[model samples]
Target: MARSKPATLKDVAALANVSRATAARALNSYGYVGDETAQKVQAAAGKLGYRGNRLAQALRSGQLPIVGCILGDIQNPFFARIAHDIEVLARECGYNLVIGSSEEELGQEVSLLASLRSLSIRGFIVAPTSADNNAHLQGLIAENVPLILIDRVAEGVDCDSVVVDNEGGAHKAVEYLIAMGHRRIGLLQDDMRIFTSRERMTGYRTALGAAGIAPDERMIAVSQSTVEHAVDATIRLFSQKTPPTALFTVDSLMTQGALLAFRSMGISIPHNVSLIGFDDFNLATFTDPQITVVSQPVSEIGRAAARLLFDRLSGKTDAPQKLRFETKLIVRGSVSRRG
Candidate 1:
């Protein structure tokens, strides 16, 4: 079989019956092309399956034309969606995304970051593994790398960050349950070592304090990012002497665990135990009672983080920014009053 030639700018121009400069003007939005002409050029480009050579362009401009995105875990729906949005926005901005996932392992994250540096990717959007990895992050900053932390922020590591307000989101979720008259609420937290987990736990505690409900250590369970661990934790929480009336899970895995435990134990949702979770998932709406959750702007956060990194690479040297987006509690069938 004969190999196909990659479509070029010339192919698009030739198919559009216009000069190369005119086609470039239309495609690059450089100005002076009529609407009809622009449409024709775009149609021809589409027909020819034309794509600009971003690498070559970047070489000419002395930049990589690629953004490095380091995700905490690709298995999580939250991170997967963020990666998809980052790629979409990077393409829209005339750039490409090089994605990597750490799976919550420290050494692997450092290795991937170092490789990206060796590949000359000076711009990054990362959801770091732990706050303990400050030195590794500081090295990137010292190298003048434009870094934006997403979802999880490293402690003592100064850089641009885009995150949903974890504490505030947790507080709202808990408060929603409280208003429904559930005094005994359980918390299923991610590994306590993770920054978001710690912040969320703090939020949960703060909400209990405000509600005049004493915090119960026995009602809280912490686990790694595994369904098995989460399920075990949920079981422990529910098996306590004074079982909680409702459960608040911090992440998608924990939510699944809590739900699975409910199913296995023959406990009906919102009747035996109400549930609320962070980071909405597709299955959240389709379950027996649609899960009530605090919805975060995952795609928006991803795009904003990428934009921040791009701005830094473009020589915008204002102080590092910390962007905190709000989360909203989506009341659904899963949460109800304790009768």
Candidate 2:
């Protein structure tokens, strides 16, 4: 069925027996209008379901001095930190930061970009869903939009990016487990869509290779994209004939899921299953035996990304900048030395 056209200001005005300008003034409370006329216009608008377009109004006034921070997951504290930093920094430079979470979806990403572009968003910091953009990102580049990618970088798109050293962090964590005499170390990771996940997996493989430890296929748990999936993966890993003595998770949320699964299954940490999770969070130390994790500088990544965005907006750097922050291993009673 063909959808009916949206009601406009003119439609509301006609129903109220008033000029469009009078209807606009009454609806927006911009200028004086008689109480009776305002009520009539309001009633007409309500009946027709008319709503003024704020984006269009902003676009008409002038180029909006706003920066948009688009993220993959809103629930992740990592993204929340980045958004906070970007908003703080952008506001300092006389710009408002608008945030939109794409929920790690390609269609949502494209729609948000299109909508924000229409509003003349001055800059964009996006943790893209996938590297393949179908030319949507390339179009943004061609349009000369100031863009900075945070946490993830696209395949063919050449733009500014601020990311943590995923491989280095993973290697550091896994190597420490090996030093503690854990030979059967398991790698629990998400789907290799995002570059960060892939990099962490690479680091896992690199660490095992360098240590002369043979990679065991059964010990690896993958296809974990959500917390529930990660919980299931942990259960599957432990259900195996010969489970790994120590486990390394790729990200914070998944690590939490693993911890929960362990608790539910009555698997004691550092006793029955030594563990190392990625991205240290508030709950790390609150755990029974505290979690040892590979900690990335969340604040650093956000500030660096905002700086890159400001630089681009200010025409300071025409060339793209890829800044990789260092990650550290924080030992906090999570992994035990194998006897």
Candidate 3:
């Protein structure tokens, strides 16, 4: 059996009684066209099942129809949601999205960026893995690539960014614990080298200072880069003869590890000690003592990043902007009233 050829722009123009130039403008949204004529062209293309060659279109205008998204850990459900939102917005803006994960490794991040650049990705939305290894990103900026940072910011890289107020959220959550008389609250977080972790740690310290509670060195634990490692860290904290009455875990992975450790130690939530998590997810509400969490606006972050990238692509030659979204504390059954 012979396969039929794909539809072409000429076929659409002939069916719509319009010139190829008008059809191209109407379809690409580059130039103004009469509403009725544009509708006719669109309908004709749809009826003929026309799919334009993106490379051809780019050659015509020196513009690519693709953007790339890179993230530190795509396994995080929140990051997954962000990726989905970015993809939807890209499609709506007539650009395709390609995603890659760096796995929080500098080498992987560098390799992914190089590969995406070779693909002619016109813009990038990235959650950088390391603060120090930013020379590669600086190269991208020097080359005049449209870039937007998400979730985390790099050192000395001036670009548009979308991040939640980690400091405020952690401060509020810890202050609430302090108000409930949890003077011996412990903090468990990812490696302090990460920007978000640093901001969150500062917030936790600020809350303790505001309440006149001297922060304990032993209770302040960092250096865990994985969920399983966090389990051991939590155990070490609980093993202290005078342990904290409450625990605040930063990030979803560490929170999961801490919860698992509590279960293994036969500890009761809000009875033996209290718990609060950062970055809310479905499991937070479903836990036995529904977790109190600092919730980031995931969809808004994705949308804002998309808008920033588009602005850059549209020849907005202005100073880069940093957008910080606020986080909310969702009080649940995790904390107990200190009598």
- The model with the greatest TM-score is 3
TM agreement with the true structure for every prediction: 0.81, 0.81, 0.85
Question: Residues 1-339, candidate 1, lDDT per residue (tens digit)?
Answer: 442877888989999999999999999998799999999999999887788876666666656878888887778888888898888878987778898888788888899988988777758888888877667788888878888999888988889999889999999999888999999989999877688998889889898999999998888888887788999888888887789999999988889988999999888998899999998888899997999999898879877887787788779999989999999899889988876
Q: Among all windows of ten consecutive residues in candidate 3, which has the lowest summed lDDT?
A: 1-10
Candidate 1 contains a number of clashing pairs equal to 0
lDDT of model number 2: 0.87
Of candidate 2, the 10-residue stretch with the lowest lDDT total is 53-62
Question: Per-prediction count of colliding residue pairs?
Answer: 0, 0, 0
List all candidate RMSDs to the true structure.
Answer: 6.0, 7.6, 4.0
Evaluation by TM-score, superior candidate among 1 and 3: 3
Candidate 2 residue-pair clash tally: 0
Give all candidates' CA lDDT scores: 0.87, 0.87, 0.89
* Stretch of 10 with least lDDT, candidate 1: 54-63
Residue 142 deviation, candidate 3, in Å?
Answer: 1.6
The residue pairs that clash in candidate 1, if any, are: none
Would you list the rank order by lDDT, best first? 3, 2, 1
Q: What is the TM-score ranking, best to worst?
A: 3, 1, 2
What is the C-alpha lDDT profile of model 2 across 262-336, one tens digit per residue? Answer: 998999998999999999989999988999999999989889999898888778756788888999999999999
User: What is candidate 3's lDDT per residue for 39-136, written digit by digit as tens?
Assistant: 99999999988998777778776667899999877788888999988998899998999899988787898999999888777999998888767998
The top-ranked prediction according to lDDT is 3
Question: In model 1, where do residues sit more than 4 Å from their true spots?
Answer: 1-63
